[model samples]
Target: MLLLSGCKVKASVWKWLHIAISCFVTAGGLLLLKHSGVVTGGTAGLALSLSPILNIPFHYLFALLNLPFFVFSYFYMGKSFTFTTIIAIAILTGLSSLDSLLPAFTIPELPGAIIGGAFIGIGLIGLFRNGASLGGATILALYLHRKHGINPGKSNFAFDFIVIASSLFAYSLTNGLISVLSIAVTSTVLALLKRKLATVKPGESRAIHPASVN
Candidate 1:
């Protein structure tokens, strides 16, 4: 992980732990997606939609495919974010291989999209709460926020809709539309909660806004 000059390495042990949990959540969120047969948006979602055509499991494909993006983030982003994404990718790969062991768990495409989208949205927000983000379009969204001073919610919404739209080729246009709707509903809920957590609440005891780290 990158550190500020004169900062000791020991300071990051806790951050590392948080990174690990964030990765786990990323994995779990993806697992939910595959089980539900919902085509999610994002690069991983792209990989997922193509997996069946290539006869590859989404998890393994995701791990391998995301490598380039991870490398890009490592160089252009920062060390800590890259480390978290690496762990996140590993966890997701492991989780994806479980299609057999957890063969019985099934979420209809609609419910799957709703629940999985909600979980994934909330998961990303949780990572951001810890002073990082989910590391996909999230990186670009950060860049947009810095470049144009756009709100985080607006940036995320635009990118997420793009991802969700790409699902049309994987599922029929109808199912794809359903998935988009589901993700939209949940993502909006998550964005609101993120803002709520950020601005501080009345009578708050311990506030943990992303800005606190800076």
Candidate 2:
């Protein structure tokens, strides 16, 4: 049990609640970036870039693109981590679908990039701290960190740069530049929180407990 606001909460319940809230925040960030015609990193950014060219919805593309990574996560990150990641992805995908229900609105590109990146970065921290990820580059980044002592922020940024480069074909030069700024913000957040989100040392069998996130 964990004491949250003077109430004792079961760890499992708290973990699931944290996952749901993180997914909602991440999904909201993606929607903001999508409406602003900007992109960040990870599968979300890739999906945004591909949606128009492929004539598909971003949420559907996001879910579809993450499938392969789940296999990788299962083999390397363990069944528990893979399972949590799947649930988190499903929640995010469900929330992202609500974009079609909301009335059209626009967020300024620069502000959206900063705010949306912050939202995503913060949400991702919650997931990673709980032994889960949003799939794609995040899965690989965490894997490398756990196995090789690599810095997740730096590795994640490298992967994001490649994704951003590919996005050039889908966005104008200005929007592409703005997308870079968005990922920079996200990577910076991750870098700053690196210590907090640090995975277990190589060969450690301990699992990340939600109550230990602080």
> Whose TM-score is greatest here?
2
* For every candidate, C-alpha RMSD to the true structure in Å: 6.5, 4.0
Give model 2's clash tally. Answer: 0
For residue 158, model 2's alpha carbon misses the true position, in angstroms, by: 0.8
Give the Cα-based TM-score of candidate 1 against the true structure.
0.73
What C-alpha lDDT does candidate 2 achieve relative to the native structure? 0.82
TM-score of 2: 0.88
Location of the lowest summed lDDT over 10 successive residues in candidate 2: 198-207
Instruction: Assess each prediction's global lDDT (C-alpha) against the native.
Output: 0.62, 0.82
> Residue by residue across 49-84, what tens digits does model 2's lDDT show?
898899999889999999999888888888888888
User: How close is every model to the real structure, measured as TM-score?
Assistant: 0.73, 0.88
Q: On residues 86-111, what C-alpha lDDT tens digit does candidate 1 reach at each position?
A: 66556556756765677477667777
Instruction: Give residue 96's error in model 2 in angstroms.
Output: 0.2
